[model samples]
Target chain A: MNRVSAIDIRNVTKAYGPTLVLDDISLKAEANEFIAFLGPSGCGKSTLLRMIAGLETLDAGEIHIGGRRIDEREPGARGVAMVFQHYALYPHMTIRDNMGFGLKNIRMNKAEIDRRVAEAARILEIEPFLDKKPGQLSGGQKQRVAIGRAIVKNPDIFLFDEPLSNLDAALRMRTRLELAQLRRRLNATMILVTHDQVEAMTLADRIVVMHDKKIQQVGAPMDIYARPANRFVASFVGSPPMNFLPVSVSEGANGAVATLGDGSKVTTRVKGLTDSASWELGLRPEHVRVSDQGLAAKVEFVERLGERTLVYARLGDGTALTAEDEGLSRVKMGDTIYLKVDGDAAHLFDADGKGYHTPEVG
Target chain B: MMSPKARREFGNFLFVAPYLCVFLWLLIWPLISGMGLSLFKADLFGGASFVGFENYSRLLQDPVFLQAVGNTFYFVALTVPALAIIPLFLALMLNRATRTAAFFRGVFFSSSVLSVTIVTLIWRMVLMSDGGFVANIIGFFGFDPIPFLSDPNLVMISMSIITVWWCLGLPMMLYLSALQQVPQDIYEAAALDNTPWWKQLTHITLPAISRTVVLVVIMQCVLQFQLFGQPQLITQGGPNGASRPIVLFIFEVGFRRWDIGYAAAASQILFAIILMVTLAQYFVASRREGRGR
Candidate 1:
């Protein structure tokens, strides 16, 4: 088995003239850990990955792979391999040559290079197409070849820059599973940069959520999903997103008593309140249930997905929020319904988008 | 009673009719007539009589014609490699996405807009043996002013220098466009693969633009094989006809000496050589492409 190496990044900053791409950021990855830098478009996640790979120059800070500073080293000398978003396979060369290209460049003997290439091809299930050029393969096969190219290098760190984004939905799912299996088999420290939260949440050992050129939150996938660091991550990481309603807060015994926009009072379990005059009440769709008494809302639209139904509702004061209900429930547009608010599962965000989470229910 | 699809196809043919007419009249008819004219003893007066293969037979023994062919081949040897290599280097230099690269690209491609006569005229002034720019610069180093156009030995070299300078812009542009079409990520991937810049150029850049290289080579060959303007305008095949190319010899024979049939025969020979070379290049390029796949 190959020994996995840890990665350390310190105070990295990158800017393009006047525009700041990556602010001062620091991260550390344990050996054999899979880290995903997840963000929206233009959020510097890919930039950070490229910086770690030594493909992009950093305006400031240092990166260390296996406790040695590699910020000044060339990308190949940095003991890292990168899988590009488009695969970037050499179209003129066969899969075998493409996989062995880096090894050959480093003066590896023909026999060793061929052995490594053959092993990578077998691992990637691309042995059948080793003699074929990239243009002759399907999209998934080409992506496998690209991954094989990175694998044959046997670098200390593997950097994946949205490697599965080009595949179709079905292929992406299958490839995502294969990548997870590969990570387990290789046990190498890998960093993936992607905008898809599901891929980040499902594949990464830890997920670093970034937004607007700064790190928003870094934690395990469920930790981030259950207890988001802020309003942006809360909304960004979840499908259908969390719902927010403007409210005024008051100190209560259990946590904080908040008044919704429609004058409905709800007691939230979130603590550590500094007595804010105005705050936003955040709730996930799964936490809001249809009940007899709570907040009164008019159902504006209904989305009946086969497994679940989503109810888009508006409060008396025109605050909109979506709630999940039984799929076979006969909820229609313009129907008035009362949604029970689970205060223990709610979240409170101050004016600055800082999120305060509630304690877990027993 | 044409079908709608047939009518649409006929309509498309109508769009091409004008060009086809001009092509047949100007190019096709002239080529066929030139071949027929090669079989006759004709001149400017047009009292032509058939002379079966005499012009071709006499051309085989003509020493001056053979020398012109040899000189033309020498010029081809000099200019073809220079045209292929120098422009590619310049294009690689200008391929970077920066203000300086754009400015240099514009500067390099600017010469291609000038007519051949104007280019030769500009070079004549710079290459004049006495009080010329080049001679004066050489004289600054305490060396004698070398005859550029008048000397039999230096005339072909001078003409080659002029032609390469005047015609480099088009191929450079071709390479620049081809270089732009190469994705930036490929080079980044190669860089991460530990490939040096020179290896990247040879292994990645060259292979990616192999088809373009073949195109530029064949175009340069065809253009260089018909070398006329530089030698005719600057050297005028001077100093005992040492710099004379085949095209200039044909001009001398047909217009000056008025041996129309002989001139036509020589032109046919030149055309045949160019055709064979171009077809051979295409053959090799396609075969290599097949092997690459």
Candidate 2:
């Protein structure tokens, strides 16, 4: 088996006139790997996906798939199939025709096209709706037909550009589960671009967190969640964003200790330079435990969400911090409590918003 | 509060009164009058003779009425296809144009807003034998100027061209509007399917706009059956009456010769021909719609 790479996109940049959309993005996926490009809207995530699909031309670098240069090829010759955000199903054709459309276009034998379409319909569990036109199908069923259209092509790489965004929430969840199951079954190289963190986390083998036309971090979902490379990712990935606090760094005999704006100091094993000594302390809501040994803050409001509660409060310096607690816990508004910032699990960013590597305390 | 029954009745009357007024005076009255007059003979000065079936009997021996009927069919055959196919082609070309779509759409549809007199006058000047723009352009190519309007064989062609040009813009605008109704996602889906442009035009674009095509074809055929002004103004019924359409013949018999009874019978024949053709077109359209469903 040729295991070099399914798709290798090198320094691909796209621009529309004076607007630079994707600024020097380079990405790759090994054979049979599933990757997700996760970012906020207008972050060039979809642009990179379209570049790999040959739907959009790259302005700067080149693209290769299955060891063949494909920057100059049309989308049909790129050995790739894409499922668009709108599903883009042909309204005039039935599901069967939609599935068999690409094969028919390439002039494949009638029997072969039928066979492939049938196989795809079976795999997507849409055989019963094969003869029904796309207008008759539900939103989820239309999306399945769109995927079935891609599947029958038997492409080496599958690119999905937010295909599940159009569905309802419950449908989105179910379809995402099915897509994850499909990736496991097919083992083809699949690249999905989504702004939904939950989708990227649940479906991707590796999630590439992108911001401002550059990749911030690329790793397994949990790994990136636990250890974001910079301040932008730390705030971007969580449900309630990570809290950032200005801190003063002082070099002591033990090492560097960061003093928070709330007058609470925590000794850290991280070292700071003499030139630029201030840092921004980052802490996730889930990591901060409500206890008696940490910083003190007054609870401003409490949001009870059945299984969990969010305590929104202000620190001594009037900085708001949200603490997630169990749903059954009864914490009244305006109640003062010791809100701990787990310094061991905390992160620090330097002046330029780049994370300063902190050696853990032994 | 007004009752629901009264409200519904008022709304129904409101919706239908506009059509009913025009339909009664313009269509129903004329139809009933023509049927009643077909049995009797009448002149332009309100002088009438109670002749039972005499005008209808005389219609059987009238060669001009037969030739008018035949010529009406010929004009329909010529102008209908020209009207339908040329406008459809223009619409397709306008649809394919990305840069100047609005400009061309405006230029094309502007013709439909012009008066019929202006249209006929313009074509009359353009198709003039010696000094017309068309003849001059042909003469510059070292070719002798052929008589477009005067020649018997060419007069019908010239009239058909003028009819096509004058009526072409409405259907082009209509087809353009219908083409706009087709969602662009369908075309993108076809592109993603790797269907070639020609196949997509055949399967996707054709089926999508087939309803408009059928409607335009039937309407154009009915319009062409009433052809008069272009042939009358440009050819004046031509050398040896080669371009004498049924409407022109009806005018000549009714007004020029004071033979209203003969013209009425001839017009009834033309109406019967139009009715048959229209019914045939509707039947075909309904059958296609059934098959499509």
Candidate 3:
């Protein structure tokens, strides 16, 4: 965050011999923005990040930084620093030497290098361990050292390749908070690649959802969460994912009506609906609630989380879905319950997976 | 009753007691008696008397003993560095596992398994003065038939070359494994830092494997110190004792001349030198390791 620079990736495509990894991919990240690329494994997110960092050569495309072309430049010359997934700290060097190594390789002034390293150590609060090697530090400390190595460079942009994936859950949460605080302080143009959706939702100013080697959606965190661009985006961005049901759409009294798999009809507010087309009704678990009178379902299981209880049930037509009940409710397996869905929060998808959403209620 | 701590200590000692027993009886007893024998003048024919440091003093002026010491050091200087450096380059070239790498690795390592007798026999055919393979090559180049093993100047070089060829496998294997231990990500990280290849080798690779270098030096030093069979079978310590190492001198003095006391004195000196060199290497390596490199 030391100095801000926008990144412009233009139609970057990559392939490994016969298999294509990314196809016609392009993205733009504004200066001083914390953008995350979230996807499942092998979704081309990490590969695209590596391409931007100059670790991988692009088969076809160009990248520009701060309005200057950097795709042809060497990695170090492009003013970008990356923290690798494994924290790639040099085991033979102490923390000070490890942080100062790249500077020394670039032939920077010794005094200036030392000053930068000391300042980075101060910022990371790792001054006490400057003389310690990587073997002596805990996992969290080594991760901070890896970040400090990037920070000492003071590059125009910082790239993180799943930097938190190796940590245990508690440490990962703490490190995520620290990273959020760091971003607030530095204002650096940072691009992070991760498969964890919660990390993307909590830390990113914007999330770029990727699937099957293509960018599915790019927007603010909540915007993408509430209104995904497609089926994959809807499923990938939320925990336990959005549920889907086969539905037949037709003109109703007020608008298009979706006859669900279990023969229940829900009115939709969709415009320019394609008549006589295959459709899918997507419902979030929260939108489906246990009520006295609604579509009947047999409770397959109940998960009693601290804040809420989730009921997994199957409809009369044997279509499985999840509904939320009161935390203190006595719902268990092998019980029948009625589920009422809020159609206003539901989504409709066509055969091609394009989404149509209900307008937000004022 | 013994204290509990003493009992536990006795149990730990008993775990290794068998090995210690063999070591003490076979190694320690001979070492102490040999040092004691060095203080006397004795032969295998039962002629014995107290000579004190007389034999040790005689050794300082003995020309053959001095030449053997010098020649042994010369062989060490030749063999140790060659065995270290050549194998390093070879290991680097063979680091990637491929069909061709496998073929060449087998070819290079096969020489190490040959017995010294067979090795000398093979090399002697190529180095024998008149009708050898190398002498024939030299003759084809309009040069006189050069004696490889018979000449004082060439015999040490010939022996060093043969020993290095025969001992190349272990160091190369160690270096290959060390190189593999350095993950590919480290090099990728270095490349992103714009580190040139030579700088990466010097600053990263060399420092990472410094312990292996020290180990190769120490191991080769100890191995090369016991150089007898090659010189004994090939040159017979000929051409004015040019290639006679310390071990050969000990064998001749102890067995042929039956001057056991004099041979024991020389053996003690050789043992002391090896111990000092090994201790010096260990001291330096441990100090560097303490600095976390």
For model 1, residues A5-111, the per-residue Cα lDDT tens digits are 89999999999999999999999999999999999989999999998887899999999999999999998899999999999998888888889989999999999
Candidate 1 local Cα displacement, residue A63, angstroms = 1.3
For each candidate, the alpha-carbon lDDT, in order, equals: 0.91, 0.82, 0.89
Candidate achieving the largest TM-score: 1
- Cα lDDT, model 1, residue B113: 95
Per-residue accuracy of model 1 over B3-112 as CA lDDT, tens digit each: 99999999999999999999999999989999999999999888789998999999989999999998999999999999999999999988888999999988988989
Task: Give the candidate order by descending lDDT.
Answer: 1, 3, 2
> For model 2, which pairs clash?
none
Residue B148 local lDDT, model 3: 79
Q: In order, what DockQ does each candidate have?
A: 0.81, 0.53, 0.48
Show model 1 residue runs off by greater than 4 Å: A360-362
Model 2 preserves the real interface contacts to a fraction of 0.50
Which candidate should be chosen as best, given lDDT against the real structure? Answer: 1
Task: Name the regions of candidate 3 deviating beyond 4 angstroms.
Answer: A1-4, A17-19, A67-72, A253-255, A271-278, A359-362, B1-61, B97-100, B125-148
Better of 1 and 2 by TM-score: 1
Where does the lowest 10-residue lDDT sum fall in candidate 2 chain A? A268-277
Rate residue B25 of model 1 by lDDT: 100
Ranking of all candidate structures by their TM-score, best first = 1, 2, 3
DockQ of 2: 0.53
TM-score of chain A of each: 0.97, 0.94, 0.96
